[model samples]
Target chain A: DAMVIQNPRYQVTQFGKPVTLSCSQTLNHNVMYWYQQKSSQAPKLLFHYYDKDFNNEADTPDNFQSRRPNTSFCFLDIRSPGLGDAAMYLCATSTRGQGGGETQYFGPGTRLLVL
Target chain B: DQQVKQNSPSLSVQEGRISILNCDYTNSMFDYFLWYKKYPAEGPTFLISISSIKDKNEDGRFTVFLNKSAKHLSLHIVPSQPGDSAVYFCAAMTGGSQGNLIFGKGTKLSVKP
Candidate 1:
């Protein structure tokens, strides 16, 4: 079935170390998004890619970056892991609909633990 | 400030009963609403959605009601089952091409058999 998939469901990294999380989609959606969710907090949008264009959230920290090499793959790279950055990283995909209210489909998510 | 809010942190319901999850929004530009369910260690899955043009939308045992004037929406599950227990999140979208969704903190629902 067409679905989103994430690799390394659980990741452990040392402080200040760089880590990357990967996402892929079989749904062939045009948009891909990355979100960080802390315990008991809302999932906050970090960045997204519409086709090849990258859009980053205003409040997203500089440590977080994303790359979309192709339609099916997107990656989130943390330049320097921090204790506060330890959270579940989610990847979502959606088709660019005419009404702008497209439903997003999410991957299983990668839980990052910064030591 | 939070654009979408789910005031209830958690809710408990008995099986075969009704479960109502409420959501409120502070943004008037939000024209579309959605409900997502998340199990532990997994990403949220889309449950149902309602457009601002409509007051309600239903599917199977789940129903979503939108009160645009009040900037509030609710999800109701009829004959709730133990399998339905999960975290429910309310999300809103502005009417544009960006499709960036603003989501509320989730409400964990526990349905006891």
Candidate 2:
């Protein structure tokens, strides 16, 4: 079945170290997104790729970056991991159109722990 | 300010009963609303959605009602099952190219058998 997949469901990294989380989709959607979710908080949008164009949220920190090498793969790279950055990272995909109300399909998410 | 709001942090219901989850929004520009179900250690899955043009949409045992004038929407689950226990998140989107979803703090529902 077509679905979103994330690698390394749980990740541990030292503070100030760089880490990367991966996401791939079989749904062939045109849009891919990355979100950061802290405990008891709403999933905050970090960035997204509309096809090949990257769109970053205004409040997203500089430590977080995303790359979409192709339609099926996207990666989130944390330049400097911080204790506060430890949270569940989610990846989602959607086919743009239909008044921009397309339902986004999400992956299981990667839980990052910064030590 | 939160564009979408799910005031209830948690709810408890019995199996075979109706589970009602309510959501409200402060953004008048929001034209589409959706409900997502999330289990622990997993990503949220799309359950149901309603457009601003319509007041309600239903699929199987799940129904979503939208009150555009009041900026309120609700999800109703009939004959709620234990498997239905999860976090329900209310999300809203405006008609645009970005298609960014504004999510509310999720409500955790516990359906006891």
Alpha-carbon shift of residue A40 in model 2 (angstroms): 0.9
Off by over 4 Å in 1: none
Point out where model 2 deviates above 4 Å: none
Per-candidate TM-scores read: 0.99, 0.98
Residue pairs with colliding backbones in model 1 are: none
Q: Assess the local accuracy of residue A44 in candidate 2 as a C-alpha lDDT between 0 and 100.
A: 87
Query: Each candidate: what lDDT?
Result: 0.95, 0.94
Write one digit per residue (lDDT tens) for candidate 1, span B1-113. Answer: 99999999999999999999999999999988999999999999999999899999999999999998899999999989999999999999887838789999999999999
Over A11-113, each residue of candidate 2 has an lDDT whose tens digit, in order, gives: 9999999999999999999999999999998898999999999999999999999999999999999999999999999999999975657789999999999
> Per-residue alpha-carbon lDDT of model 1 for A24-107, expressed as tens digits?
999999999999999999998898999999998889999999999999999999999989999999999999867657899999
